[model samples]
Target: MPPNLALEIKCRESERQALLSFKQSLVYRYDILSSWTTQAKANDDCCNWIGVGCSNNITGGDYHITRLDLHNTGLMGEIGSSLTQLSHLTYLDLSSNEFDQIFLEDVASLINLNYLNLSYNMLRGPIPQSLGQLSNLEYLNLQFNFLEGEVSEVHFSKLKNLKALDLSDNFLRNCTLGPYFPRWLRTQNFSVLDIAGNMISDKIPRWFWNNLSPNLLFLDVSYNFIKGKIPNLSLKFKTMPVIILGVNEFEGTIPPFLFGAQNLDLSGNKFSDISSLCEVNYSSPLYLLDICGNQIFGHLPRCWNRMLNLASLSLAYNYFSGKIPHSLSNLTRLKSLNLRKNHFSGEFPSWFNFTDLIVLDVVDNNFSGNLPSWIGLRLPNLVRLLLKSNNFHGNLPLSLCNLRRIEVLDISQNYNISGTIPTCIYKFDALTKTLNASEVPDYLKDLVMMWKGKETLIHGRNLQLQRSIDLSCNRLTGEIPNKITELVGLVVLNLSRNELTGQIPYNIGQLQSLDFLDPSRNNLCGENQDRLIVQDLLFAISSGFIIGFWGIFGSLLLFKRWRLAYFKFLRNIIEKPL
Candidate 1:
């Protein structure tokens, strides 16, 4: 045998071994890889697909699979141990799929792996300790899964190079760090850390914030059972873009440092006093500040002029009182302003101008006087206007018709206006559906019926872009307009609590797109028990004819009484004839 022939044979054998190893690495546990056949593999150009990566150069011209990403592909089945054959694999992403009981013991074999993502899946069971063997791993994301078990220091302390970690939206229980924070986590300079929506219960350790890297910018620990006073930061970083600690059982006054931060969201908590926020230097560029659903009390900070770049301001469901500052008009860039369910009192701010405002929700406030007519005209971009349960007066602003982009307008319970609804109000082409007015005149009722016959009402059917109107409590009187049926895109119609007296047009039932309909507490009387019914027969009888019928019946009864008296008189006269 020649030496060259023997060498060729050896080379062929090595190639065969490489191919077999590559095929084995593709298989997983629970027969999951059975559906991923060779034909399907060929469709992806021999595994050089979008979600797969290889390191052929490092493995001496052999295909060394490194990365496997199968996110959002509707994949199902348990992970297989065959995946361990890819010793050089580094990155693996299987998020937003249906993988259940994801075995992790086999993952420890991939010693050279770096990034791993398994979020938004049905994976369950305790995390494997073998995961710590990945010494060079950097990022690990396992959010939005059903994995349960106590998260111990042993599970995380081994990953020394982890820079970005997200274990949010899980059922992990009892995540208490005894006295001090994990020393291994403190060593790594993580920039993004999210452990939100978990069952972790314990006082937020001080060392957790103290040891955070100066470069940390985003930190989310929300939706947990963690309680205790919020730690005060050293203010070392120049910019902390996002800090979300909402939906927790945290109690105590919010630290003053929160007001100075750029994006502070401490909503859904038990903070009692936020007046300290008013003292924060507003020189910083704070874009979003949401502190809704808290026990905070005190007047809104009048220093709103300093937050020039503020975009969203939500302080709803609080005990805040005092006149809404007219200075809020200075927040010209404001897009959303929600101060609903608060104890705010005083006249509606005349200078309140939100040119860029998309959502202006001030419902359930102690506001008085006519709604600002300029609200619709000035804020053309307004999408939702909820001013219910207030002391607003005057007729519906005709200028509100200028809100061509308005989708929702709920102003029920403000019972101080009296007048026929203007016919021109229906001209808002952008109007999808409106609330029943409290004081509908006869003419407006007729107009509504007329509009219902138009064919152009079927334009906007999508719920996202549809418009709806609600006018449940008013002094409107007249037959319900059939034209209301013309609003083919109407999703909700609430005309309850009005003095409207008339028959509800049968055509109203024709509104196929109507999802909600309420006409309660109205004078409407009709055959439809759910609708108001008007007495057409009573209206048809003329006044002269009704008077004639009463006169005839009275004459008949009088004649009978006279006959009895005459008979008695005759009897007395005959007896005295002598």
Candidate 2:
């Protein structure tokens, strides 16, 4: 071989060795990628490799790896410093993997990384301040992990090109706004930002809204302890924004201008009157509006129809009253409507129509009259129907059985309705659990009995019983249903405070899952002394039986003549009912 030919061969081999070194570094840095064997790397194909993207060079020499994504691969080792060798890498995603505390320092070396996601991992310690070096980064997601640190303004003020930032679900504590929560962030082209589920408390800095650029499209600060009134910001952005400020301690009325947002969620706040919202025109392309779990009062805003593009509306746990607006049906795209735990009084609106409706929760309201048969027929896609604690009269709608996909159906507190529950309810494949209908009307007494039953006396594990039924505190009369034993999943039975008579069914013992039993305050007579003794013994063993002795002695004394003596003593003080 000539010297020139030998030199050319040596140069080619040097380039090949460099490429091999880079590939080996990637495998060593991430534990999951280490599985790629030396044989697999020998293949002359770069495009077919897993989790790597390669683009052909304009000179047609070789393909260069442009992207590397190894998300959720259970990689349980410290990120090695060798990753910095991937100089051509533009994208790196090591999200949802376990890493040690100091890995962030090594990650900071990836200066060219534009898209970096390290979310949902067990990485701990303060976010390395060196992250500020990534000036080219556009998208950064570090959510749902145990990353703890004080996210100061200095830490985030440097990422000028960042468009999306998610740091939710972290142990970040005592975070105070540093000269306005990275106010420089507004100057950049950020569209989506999520900083929820942190210990961030303090009045929402005014600079957040004042400096917010119209280019901002999505903002989420939910599940933080933020307090103070929501800021009223002037709209300057051409596109409507989606804002979520739920699960905070925010007080005062919601800013009416917020209605202009496309997706606004102010739920779980201390707001009182949202009537100011009626003044705002909802002509914007709003999609979701959630103000649930607040002190919001006043009637349903008739202007709701203005938001024709609305898809989900939740105003539950408020003091709203009067009829639900039939105008709501105008939201043809509506899929979810939750107005539970309000004072709204009126019959179910006949005009409520939406073929795409999936969730309808109007529970615990003052709504009266019969259950609309057409509700089930109209909302065939309904998944959750909660109409409990209302004044609804009439029998249970048999048409409700038609909802094959319904997962949760709660309509327990309407006293005006008479007759048995539709047995077809048991046939729904999606019905995984059902609350006892009898417990709602007389909830206080039934709750006490339920509490007593949970006392450790039953000594059984995973006992299956009949459906809990509480028909107490009503006009219900007649012997206790013997068929109750057929409901093998029942856990509680309360027939107290009614005109129920006749001996207690002996088959009641057949309900092995019957943890709670309350038949007091009724006309039911007769006593199974042996059964009562066993129940007392079980209760004693489970709960240390502090009161069982007193109960048994009191019952025996009453049976003897204590009641007659008490009556005589009362007769001496007052005139007898002769």
Candidate 3:
């Protein structure tokens, strides 16, 4: 072998040994890198490790570690400093681990690192300023950590190659970035920037709209103490696809240009006047919009019908009044619609174009008129149907029983809805077993379950345990059908304040999973009354026998004359009373 080649091989072996130190620091129950053993008989090449990647350096003609991805490995323990020894590493991802107290300065030696993700860990302490030396970094994510202290501009001043930066869900209250929008962000050309769920209290600076990089595609600064009116952008964000500014204190009208964003979440803000939202460009392709919990008033703009790509729309808890625009049916891709706690009046539109809707919540509205049965026929995929606290009248639609995937059905508080509860409620498949639609988002599938008479919102975990039926406070008069017992998985049943009469179903005890039942103020009677009367008669007979026996025995023992007189009186009455 050539002298240079022999030395290169020796260096590779030594660097391979350095990797073992990092492996020892982590506790992997599944042993994701079980191949990383030290036995001579085992595969000694570090390149063969489960999450390690290697490539040959053309100049050095030796293999070097270039990537180390151990995300979601169930690994725990502090990220040991030995990882810095891999000087040739360009990609390092230790996300979704239990690593704690990870000091960024320890990994500063890896100057070649172009991608670093330490997100979703228990990392604490301040970010090390030495990270700024990694000029080659293109992606850096330190989100969802316990990190504290300031993160000044100097920490990222030299990262000219950075295209994406995420430091959300961290304790950056003392960070020098903001009490206002970070001015330093203007110097960087970030395509993706997320500083949400932090303690950044600041007004969105005026320059933010004018100076946004044309290359920017995604921006999020939600869940902060940001306050002020959003200024209109002169330069149209033609290429930007997402902008999330929800859960903030931003007031005033929404910028007209913002309607062009494909994915927007401006919920939980104090913004008012949605007149500009009605003027979105015809060609705009908005998909997801969550402007709920805002003070925005006025009717929905007619332009909403043009958003053909719209999927989810949440306008709940707003002051918007007037009938739902007929144009909404034009959004054929609509999957979820929430207009709860609004003043939308008039009869609900009978026809709808969005047949694939999964969630529809229109609770606490002034909607009067028969709930169009088309809701069940048109939206067959309904998972959560919340229509409570409305003026909807007439008999409950029997077609609603066809919604097999429904997990929650709340139609209570509509006094005019007078009819017997549907017997086909047991056919709802989602209530029969725990739903396993993990493929969909959590917001799309959820139900308000009643456990021990307390209502609780449930989603994802333990959600399948919720099966409720609320038809109380109405004028409905009829006996609860015995078929209701078929819904053995029912967790809550409320038929109170209704005129329902007749004996309670004999099979009521079959609902073993039932946690709550409210039949009060109704004419319903219990079928167990006969059994209870028999029990009372048996108790009375037993008490009488015990008293008679004790009295006769005591008198015979203490008063001989009284006992004889009592016996004689009983014999005379038995012989002559008839």
Candidate 4:
């Protein structure tokens, strides 16, 4: 932006007043609007204001504020009508705010707008038909909103100059834009297009595959009912694009040409064999490939050694059988691997070459034999280790204590594992810490899990359980480990159905992060059960408080009896004897 020296003489008074009216219709969490004042003392300059950019007009009109970017600012409320008054605006972004829907209905009046983003807001209702009037728009993003209903050609009638369009995470479903694929999409060339999670159900037309933009670098149409096989478009994309078509009804084998992309997710489809994995030439640049929850089966592919850049691979929830091939161990940079819910059997190969693993999930399979003792040493950075419902047997490995960064460890329901719980369990350092939902690590969001007794596949983000250990449903004998209470970050602790005898740890209440706990069906019985239950109930309440004082524990808030009883429990723990 060029320097704005003369603010008063250059800025048009009417446009500056329009900006003030724009600020009037909203709520502000900070005094960020102080510079937008109309007071004479502050110079009443709109062009020099924060987030406001002005440019000299070719016709020599007053310097007009051509840009207004207030993304992620703490502004909330409905879109003001005064925005349309700034007719010279060519760039505007009001994303990631607690904002409105009416803006779309009037934003089209700014015909000069070449870039616009209102994503991650509280906008609702049908997308306004007037948006089609932005003929010069090159970028438009309305992702993460509540807009819905059929999207017709009227929505994009004059948007021929559009280069990037993202309408992800809404309830929209239609075509003309959803009984069929958008017929008009083939006309406009897009560098980035994301229409994921809209209920558009139709086969991707062949013309779309033929006329795919050569400049396309990102295309996501996942989480819908769209079908038809994805064709190989390696030659179409001049630069490798990140393509995601997951959770759709697409059928047929994945094309080997897709391996040419930088990142690809064809998971949750009917794609048959990954024989294409072997067809790709060595030195493949693919870094992430998730084909999980498909019907692809047969022995594990042995060509993983070819893709040296492959770091994250997820093939869970498929019919894959046979031992994991040794070639998979060749990728030294492998970080995350998910192979759960398959027929993979045999003791986990003790010779893994990839030490960069942060997430190693192989749950609910038929793999047998003892848990590998070398895992803790081989993958020191392992954060999540899930191996539940497998046929693995034998005592818990003491070497697991060396995993200081382990946050999630589920070695449950493998009945044959026996012996006392390790006393060095406190050595798993990450469990001893605490974190709220918003503070959760980015990579952990890749998981889909539910809390409480039922473990279902739901996108984890809200009230989802994290951290903790699950060593339940085993033949392990001996007393409950008292040192386990040191793990203040443990969220779900299920030690039920084990032969463990003795009293519950008195300091178990120290686990303030416990969301779900089950010591029932074990030999942990005594008059202390009431005391322990009450103590854990308080922990559950605190856990609920950590993730916003609502959800999952609402019964205590809504019912008077439960509310009084909770207060009584609190009074008892304070005044009465145990």
Candidate number with the higher TM-score (2 or 4):
4
Write model 4 residue lDDT over 1-578, tens digit each, in one string.
Answer: 44654334566778888888988898989988888887643255677778898888788655888999999988899886899889999999999898865567688889999999998898888888889989999999987666766687778868999999988655342221465678778768888998775557999987877767766789988766898886765553468889998889988878777787788898889988888778776578788889898998898889988788988888989999999899987788888889989999898886774678888888888999887878788888887888888998888888888888887788888988998888899897877767633233453344543245568442234324567577877888888778888887776677777887877677675554332234565666433556656776776576557644443255443433244345435544665656
Clashes of 3: 0
Kindly list the per-residue Cα lDDT of model 1 for residues 1-578, writing each as its tens digit.
86553223111223234334444643343443343334322333334444556555655665556777777776676677656666767888888877785778887777888888888887888777777777788888887665666666777777888888887655443332323334556656677788665445667777666766756677877765677887666554456557788887677778766655568788888888765555566464778888888888878767677778788888888889989876677888998888888988877777877888877778788988877777777888776677877888777777877766665666776776544444454555555444522121121111101011121221111222235566656655555665555654454455666666676656665433322234455766554543322222232244226434543454333332233234335445755757
lDDT of 2 by residue, 142-204 (tens): 865656646765666778888888876554433423223344555556788886654457676
| Candidate 1 weakest lDDT stretch, 10 residues | 443-452
Which pairs clash in the backbone of model 3?
none
Q: Which residue runs of candidate 1 sit more than 4 Å off their true CA positions?
A: 1-66, 70-76, 171-188, 236-240, 256-263, 276-283, 433-467, 476-483, 502-506, 511-521, 525-527, 530-578
lDDT of 3 at 569: 55
For model 4, give the 10-residue run with minimal summed lDDT. Answer: 436-445
The global C-alpha lDDT for each of the candidates, from Candidate 1 onward, is: 0.63, 0.62, 0.74, 0.76
Every model's Cα RMSD, please? Answer: 21.6, 14.5, 18.7, 8.8
Looking at model 4, residue 431 earns an lDDT score of: 75
Between the candidate structures 1 and 3, which one is better when assessed by lDDT? 3
Candidate with the greatest lDDT versus the true structure: 4
Candidate 3's displacement at residue 137, Å, is 1.5
